[model samples]
Target: MKKSLLLLIAFSLMVMGTQVQAAGQDIRLVVDISGSMNRTDPNNLRIPTANMLADLLPDGSEAGVWTFAREVNMLVKHGLVNDAWRDQVQEEAEKINSVGLYTHIDHAIETVTWDADWDVDKDRHLILLSDGLVDLSQADTQEERSRENQASRDHLLRERLPQLVDAGYTLHTLALSDEADQDLMATLAQRSGGLHAIAYEADDLMPLLLQILNRVVDSEQVPLEGNEFSIDPLINEFTALVFHQPDAEMVLHSPSGESYTRESDQSNLNWHGNARYTLVTVKEPEAGDWQIETPAHPDNRITVVSDLKLHTSSFPATVYRGFPDKEQTLKAWFTEEGQRIDRREFLRLLDAQMQHHQDDLLLTEKNMPFAEDNLDFRASLTDFDELGEQQVTVLVDGHTFQRQVTHSFNVQDVVAANLQLPENGGTPKIVLRAQHPQLDPDQVDFQVTANGEAQPIDYRGDGEWQVDLANLEPGREYLLEVEAEGKLKGERLNLVLPSMRLEEGSVRALDRQPEEPQETEESQQTPPDFVPNIAPQVIPSPVLPTPSASQTEEASEEEQQPAQSEEESDPPVDDETADEEGLFEMDFSPIKSWDDPRMLWVYVALGLANILLFTLAFILYRRFIRRRKERHDAQVHDDEDTPEIDDLEFDLDDELDPGK
Candidate 1:
């Protein structure tokens, strides 16, 4: 009876779990076909890239492709990935041509997302590729056209982007040329937690798109080193991408030294060769090392479709030098499909290490310690002491198989927010001094909380914000978050301040009770007037160590200042708007249907042809009517000149005389 009851409970739990939808990736691809693409991508490399993407998509994932310019078109209708869907995509890719007049980016996005459904269990991703700024054809002045374009961009960012974020969409954007709007593309990626890349030339599009795809989708890949990659027994299938020159020969060598080429007739191997790249998919690939005999290319890759794979956590794009809390902690483990592999015997032979590098210099290499449960390995990333772009690769080397993943991040200066606990009993203030001169003081926002409840903040001039902590029960902690916009060089930047923690009575200098009158006034602060300000000061940071009361007092005195009145603290709304005007760069040179000299001449020629056609038609109609009237008059005159019945009597008499 006990065994039967256990089985019954397990079945009930499984049934309950089935009520939730399974997690799957739904990807939408949006491409631009504007007229500018004629110069940007004259060879139409996007077609081959799209085909490769369709073939490489996983079996259970759903995807669709769209092409847009003045109008949005569904090139490949959204559907589940299957052989039929892929064939249809291949057929439809040929229809993409560079004949569109305008680039209506907002309309394309709206059309793609208007009727789409969202599910909590699925991750929806939109990959947008473009090569030019937002241009809409209109008959207006250059400045007016620019304003309209800005308005369209603003609407897309302010309204549609938030909806996508709320619906859990990762929007990866690609800017294809120097003329493309890099800021907007970067902002979309940052806001949506997606990857963004810029392609300086058309040739770079394929490699960059592949990079974005690999990041967005957690597909397992075997590391290709020196044009060779090893495949283990657990891998059911694998796809290899090889790039080559036009005149060079490409070949694939199998584990048993069997050579395969484009002409090889094998039921298990599907070879797709192109002018620039060859994509090969193998079913039930043989175990052992395989080699692609082609010229060395950086973009050569191999991804696998398998049940057993290595799963790892994603790393941040940026980390601070002195902030330990913001440090990336890598947690990785092996899995059979989606279930965790927890067998000790299986995990014992596996080794995982993270190799860090800056440019060509090797910084450090460390191993991830296994957990007690033998399920996952973790290690704190502590090698970010230097500034600049850094690359880290996680390599998992097992007895028979190997897997690796690499990503890059930037190390920046420590941006701190310090909470000044008053030496004498009063309201605690948070001070953040401006570290960069271009930091905008007016464009700031704060998300502050006290003991899990929303706490109001009063913005005082000079980078100080006052918060009330009088009602704290002496042991609870609070959280504060600050976000601001600033400028770097000549370009605008979105600055995300680190979240700071404040514990009650932890850093107080003395055991003093709060003053009653000041406490009452601080508690009564309103929410609307709690604006934020930016300045150069240190706030609480993970690198901060607990200091004595005197140390805290000294830091507070150096940073703190007298609070300003509400009128003086609030920024002028007009000046803020003026400063932000012309954020979107619009090119008026492309708007030239009526402005182009050649088009003007074409219009004049068409107008003259219409006038000549009308005159010829009128002349022909008048001649036809005149001819008909002349024929009628000739028949009437003949009837009038001839004799009638009165002359019949004379005719009869003449006939009788002729008979006699």
Candidate 2:
């Protein structure tokens, strides 16, 4: 049972670890689709480059493609890198034929950095491929618009790129042409701890992209010592290099039995430092293993660089300043050929250097048995007391196999600034507090503005500033801008604090009011029934007089009686004319009382119905009482007839004898 429980726990942990590693990668490919690409590229290399990138990316990695000219359009939303996604991305990429007129590089960067769907805990990368010719002109004029656009692009690079870096997104830049902005690209890459590479022509783009993808996916290194070394590249366009022997003769054989020696085909082979190292470039290499033969120096190592990946436990942004004697550990590792090399002597042979402020700091390898798959090394820094803009560099030894990585940390005495606003209405008072020991109270300057207009600021003692907002209008927004200038570690510091807005009330009103419904002429007109003057008065018809029973009987009997003489009938004609005259005149009189015998009979019937209802109700109540009494009597009888079981006794001895 214990073993089974342990196995179950281990399985759960393994599944969890797989889930953590398989959180997948998010990569945004921001491509330039301006009209200039048509003239500069001519061959339409961007589409093919995107295709190569999609093919090279690891399966299940989510990627999004964005193209920016006048505006940015998403070709492929972030999705898993399946075969269908690859095909879809390739199709959309083909549609980008450089038709747009303007290049909005700033807009593209802002959209990808802020608007793109990013998984915060997962590995996120932004691969920007542009000519860096940012043209944001949308007006009729040219020169003035160009200047504004250039300034906007410069501001984006200076401000937004740092924010992206601080948010922990690595941005890799690829400059496609000689006219591309190299300085901006390098700055972006360096600040974000990403690699920056240049492509002089269209052909160099694919390899540069492949290198980036490899860094994101996996990296490995294989040491070669024998006369014959073979390497199997599963993917096409694999880069291989053999280093540390200048005079060694080398021969390479393709899988198709084509041989390439130092003297035969030297086009693909590039030598560094007088044939000290050779870099072999294989374009669309075969699937089978390729052999490399070196005659001299069998012990000399040939390091096969597959992918270059740097993993650190604590990044530069995470490092904090401590006391002068306080010791802090910096752990880092590098992966090559998908394997972790934690050997101390092997790491020492690489000659890794860690420097801070032009001083080389010594780093010792730290063994981490719990992390078997990660190569862990630690460096101790004792003098972190000097604060403000500290940087460290880590690099390997050889030129061909060397990796130069630098990370910067801002060591400040004050980590954050605290600002307190007044609660009541009056001249607004703001209290500025510094959280660090070295921060001076007098160096901070606070300026308040109401609706873009500056207000008078009165500086009180001990980091407090009072702004006279007495003349300022209420129910309006006021902005507070704070500037803190101080000196730390012999470096001048000018910091612009976060802008804060204050309104008269806790919640500010919306800028615009909701539109109200309009009243039409037809709606305003009231109906004739609703208006007293125009209302039609309805006159009711007169009620007909009911005939007496005797009169009705006399009329029926007269019809059955024998007819009188013509003279007797003629006497009734005058009476009939009088009846006709009476019928033409209607009696207009109010009904006073109902004194007819039929009305008396109706009142008598209603009284009889009320008495009948009362008698029926009385009968039902009597029946209910009688039934309830009978049920009570029956219950009493049942209780009396039921005998108690406790009173009855059994003869156990007699019963036992009868069974035997």
Candidate 3:
């Protein structure tokens, strides 16, 4: 029993080790297809570089390809790396044409970061290639447009990049040209715990890509143990020193002789570890030799973390790509060193030319609201129908932040085939319309099958084809299978029409009909009379008396007297006779008061008061005007009489006297 137990334990350990080794890494290659890439890389070596990288990747690894120009496109989705997949990827890479108009780095990164299938338990990496900074130029002048474009790209990078880093995804960047934003690329790589490389020409790209891939795939830890050892780091490069034994006391001396013990609080050093191991990360290490000393344990091991270091896992990766007409949302939460920063101003959208095009501005609904919380600022984009590149700019604390994006307006081919029935109850037919750019009308052929039997179709000119369904039964569902072939190779299309019900009264239409109300036997039966179960009305105890005939007659008489008096007091005037006598003139009798028999006197007094006020205003206005004129004349007279400061006295008199 003891021997059997030992064998079982050993088997279990072997299985666990196999499982750990089987966990694979996910790597995505993101390439730039912008117009600038075509200019910078005249040899068009990106495709070959990508193919070479694919060849170098280890078998059974997960890898994918994504490209960005004015927009992002996933040529090969993430899948297991095998011989077939590598060949397929190579073919797709060969098809990549440098026809895109803009460099949308943010969109490309976001696409891989968000859209790709990322396995968190396994290692994840994003290899980015770009020839230049994000270009969103819509400006007339190159200088202004470039400035705006950089600002927009910077804003987007700052806002969306931290999410990738925070998610634990390492980003490796390859700068493809001299104009590439080296600082930004390096910053992105460092923040994401990755590496950045620069390629001055097309020749340097493939080798660099291969080197990075090899480092990631074949990374091995080098053990170090000694009293004194030298460590050198590249200038402005991130370096890390890891001690395997947590209890080991170590002292590190910088090139400047600055000594740092394990407990030293150095600004550039970020320390984190446990009992098993301790790690120290130095940002932008000094470009000189450094020394380490550990007196505690002879068994202590030191590991160097440099550009060749590989990460096992990274942050969730995603990328966004779509047509220009669709709305895109960009979100970012502002924070500094884990503290929220609420100093953002506003976010704006620019066209491909990097100009302030009002038509391309983000929709009001997509605007990011300024708030003090840690919630993300979101902007909705719309009306970016201009083909090629666009940009989103966010203003943070008076600094311009920007991101370049691309879009396409290409519409895919659509096959519109539907069943139509005659309104007069004749043969049902299938109507077909092919909406494809490359479809040749003469070469287009279609076959229809219903209920596992072939159906006859009549070809009509002008790209219209139809199939008769007279043999099919009416008011019954039938399955339809349609096969269509276009002129281009591999342009075949197959469509299975939904089960459709035929009608005897008319031909069945493709559009769905509303369900008619059903009449059941119970509903058809007559409804019983709705008898009232209400209680009887109650009678009042005291009833009011009805008016007598005399009282009613008196009320009628009183109402008639007013009408009679009004008629008797008023005189009847004929309108025609009154017009001749000028009796239609305006009347002032209504304004005549009871105390004053005539209102004419009041009107006369008002008219006099108005005249007096107007006379006074006019006199004052004239006097004011005269005084202003006199002041203007006086100033003019003074200006004319004033002598010039440069005039010299007696110079002309002296010259004239001498000449005479």
Candidate 4:
């Protein structure tokens, strides 16, 4: 009874754990058919893109499609996916066109999510594609129309976005052209922890959609190198999406040297040839090497359905330059079903690498090594100097199979300032420039502090500030902190600048070194490395302080000290080290705890649930087992109460002696 009860309780806990992680992923497509799309998407590439995404969506996952113009219409009803659902979506995709007079994005989103059951066991996602700003046809006058559109946008941002965030709905947005509302799309994605991409041309839609799918689904991949990949025994089915020239044909070669094409009479193959791309799926594929003969394209990929999969940490969509608490770290591991794979023999055979890309250029590559326990792989991304869209593709290579996943993020500077500290004991001046074009420089104000006391700043023309050090003592080290406040795109930006060390009439930024050997005259001509500034504007804050006398003494005592390079000399301390050294702090807050009434109620409800479950389990065991025991005891007692045959012997003697 105890063992059974233990098993039942274990099963209940497992179910709760699975719910916490969520289950399969669900995606909803919301497309714009605004009249402007007639010029942006002249080829009607969205039809095929939608069809392809439907094909790629695995079975048992939930998906739906909706298109909006003046009216919101459902192309595919949201439900669990199957062969029928995919076919319906393909049939319905043909109806998508840029004939509508207006774009009713607000109405479309509301209708799609009006009856959404958020309690479903799935990770919800919404892919919103647009080629124009929000427009509605309900107003008679042009001014009324503009007013209504702005109101609708405000409602979507202020009300709808917060609800979606609370309900765990990630919104991946795509801007189909320059005329599209890119800022709104970016805001929605960023606020919801989703992805946003710009399709410079209509033809770019398919590849961007594929990249988004790479993040949406949990599918393992077989890495393709030079158009070749290997399949393993564990693979049940594999699909390859290959991009080729408009007139070029793609050929697939199996390990046995057998070549197949779209014309091949293979019962286990499904081939789809579309404009600029071809998708092929092979079932029960042979477990060996396979190659595709086609023009090389970076977006070409192969995804497989298997029990063994590669899972990775969700990289941030945006990386802030000066936030130490928001540092980016990437991790990957193998999993079978829902559990992590820890067997060393299997892990030792695999190698992992991350490829960093900026547009058509490959910025760098990083090798991900297994942890000391040899259970997973991890890599810290420190080389983010490139300030633009960065796509990181992680590839795990093995003898028979491989896995790959791509993530993209943008690097943005919060503030751009250069501290011109004199080496010859002169005046300390700051040349502060706005990195973001939207920042209003004239309105920016600074709060300067020297040794925890406020200092007066003399603002000079053209983004220059002169710090008066006449009253300050010479040769005494001073810790200087600068805070900038400004109007950025009509919003207040608070920026925290890196601290500076001023001593002996010289000043240097503590987060950086006093001298840079690799900094060339030409490189210095460009903007300085951005420092965090806040107060209704952007800039990264510093966590490191100037080296103390004790640290300098320890550095001198070390006999075999390595040479300090420009980057290594005095880098800003990470959050972990900052906590250990107790130098600075990063602010974080929890929404729920003992202090919140809602949290207290939630905890009380959970405690009551646990008690109820325990009581129910105890009653079930006792009721059944105790009843069975009682029945057995009653039978034994009845047998004892009845006279035995040995006792009847005396009666037999009495009967023989004639009724004594």
Instruction: Give model 1's TM-score versus the native structure.
Output: 0.59
lDDT of 1 by residue, 52-73 (tens): 7887787767899999987899
The candidate with the higher lDDT, 3 or 4, is 4
Q: How many Å off is the CA of 127 in candidate 2?
A: 1.3
Cα distance off (Å), candidate 1, residue 604: 31
TM-score of every prediction relative to native? 0.59, 0.39, 0.31, 0.60
lDDT pick, better of 2 and 4: 4
Which structure among the candidates has the greatest TM-score? 4
Q: Report the lDDT of model 3 for residue 397.
A: 23
Look at candidate 3 and tell me the lDDT of residue 182.
48
- Candidate 2: where are CA atoms >4 Å away? 1-22, 114-119, 223-289, 292-660
Candidate 3, 210-257: lDDT as tens digits: 445543564322223243433444123333333334366556777889
lDDT, model 2: 0.51
The lDDT of model 3 is 0.50
Give the alpha carbon lDDT tens digit for every residue of 214-322 in model 4. Answer: 6687666777887998899888899999988776889999999999999999999999857678889999999889999987788888889888888888887766564
Clashing pairs in 1: 417-539, 417-540, 418-539, 418-540, 433-535, 433-536, 433-537, 434-535, 434-536
Error of 3 at 527 (Å): 86
> Candidate 2: lDDT of 110?
84
